[model samples]
Target: MYLSYEETKDIAYYMCDRTQRLTLPMLVNLLLDVSEKQSDSLERGEAYIRDRGLNWIILHYAFDIGRMPRLNERVYIETFATEYNKLFTYRTFIVRDSNRTELIKVETTFALLDSKKRKMARIPEDIVAPYKAEYSKRIRRNKKPDEVNSEEYNEKQYAVRYFDIDGNNHVNNSHYINWILDSLDSTFLLDHDITRGVITFNKEVSENQLVFSQSSIREEEGLNSDHIIKTEDTVHCSATFTWDKVKRRNMNGYDQ
Candidate 1:
């Protein structure tokens, strides 16, 4: 079994929303940061993979959030490589409050992309050996993100900023989540908190691309938001968010 790597972070002002809770996009970025730190510690970071003509690319993410970390609150985040198959690797992240209560649990899938060919590449044993992730032939099937229907949606267009591109020369994964959230109106965002989310990336968006973000809400057992991000030619990403009305107590907390 792979040993989990952990980190403690104090939620900074920039990472928090008006209500003093950590913003979802920054929360996702924090997960990525911890994962990168782990890889770098093991000498299996981005440079190592790129040297082998491959880059790690995220395919999907599923998040179960109990509550958002409040501003100035220190939380512990733990992550480990759960397992890997021929094509994809599965990882898990757990975020806990100072008292050790789990605030969020996340499962993510990642695959190797051949840098030159821009195609999915098979996982090599040598590459994953460092993580001690169990090798399995059986592929884990995660639920596909729900398709966005043809119904009217709130749409916004954004020009990919220079900072959005990572060293990999592609738009960073967390920005897609940001776009999805930004498509929603401020009122909706302020009143509701995302309790769960599923996001899947279909293609990569590059620098200077103008991407359209579209979102529509569905009222079922609870409030659900479906989102799509696409350029003129391709649908780059799609996601679904399940929300709960923000509690007054949370909204009244200290604003840092």
Candidate 2:
């Protein structure tokens, strides 16, 4: 059986940027809410046992945006679990227009965390059995993002306001998206839209902690770069973003 969920999004805030299209952080928020409906997630059956006090943490995620939906555009997202292993479970999502035209695709890996112990937990079989585990994956699994050197990066700092923290007492993954993308100057962000990205979350940053967002340019592959988010000494997260003027594809793989 394929456990599925659906939602529609309308861009009503500055969240989309001057490009007038949905931003990556908004897309991430959409998927995160959608993820709760899965049988394997903390919000759903069997997995929802509260006394056990378990939650899910994203280890890594990647998405490909073939087209960015415009402001006031209502886009539909359909998501389902692809499969799961001992420690990691994979899910895929597709974004479509009202007429069913495909607009975007995303895949992510999640790990179960025992809240009390603060450690990774193995996924139970009952959780994996319900998904459409056909050994299919839309995108290849991504490794942890590289840690950038402190001296060789452009950086910005942000305060962890109350709203930025989630129930986990840390900056919500959705807000981290904004901090990373926002570090890029407007001229570059306006000229190029995100075609794909990979983010790996390492440590956790709690409320009142100062966040340092760091980035570096890689001009070789269309427009690509790496980013890191940390405090004064310890790292919290890292990611890589690849942008293009527009989607470029070949029969074998992505052209850019």
Candidate 1: tens digits of C-alpha lDDT, residues 112-164: 99999999999988888888888888888776766666777899999999999
* lDDT (Cα, tens digit) per residue for candidate 2, span 91-179: 88899987889989988887778878888887666555656565433444676665555567778899888889776554789888888
Candidate 1 residue-wise lDDT at 5: 97
Q: Which candidate's lDDT is highest? A: 1
Q: How good is model 1 by TM-score?
A: 0.95
- Residue pairs in collision within model 2: none
Candidate achieving the largest TM-score: 1
RMSD of each: 1.9, 6.1
Q: Give the range where candidate 1 is weakest over 10 consecutive residues by summed lDDT.
A: 247-256
**Residue 108 displacement in candidate 2 (angstroms):** 0.2
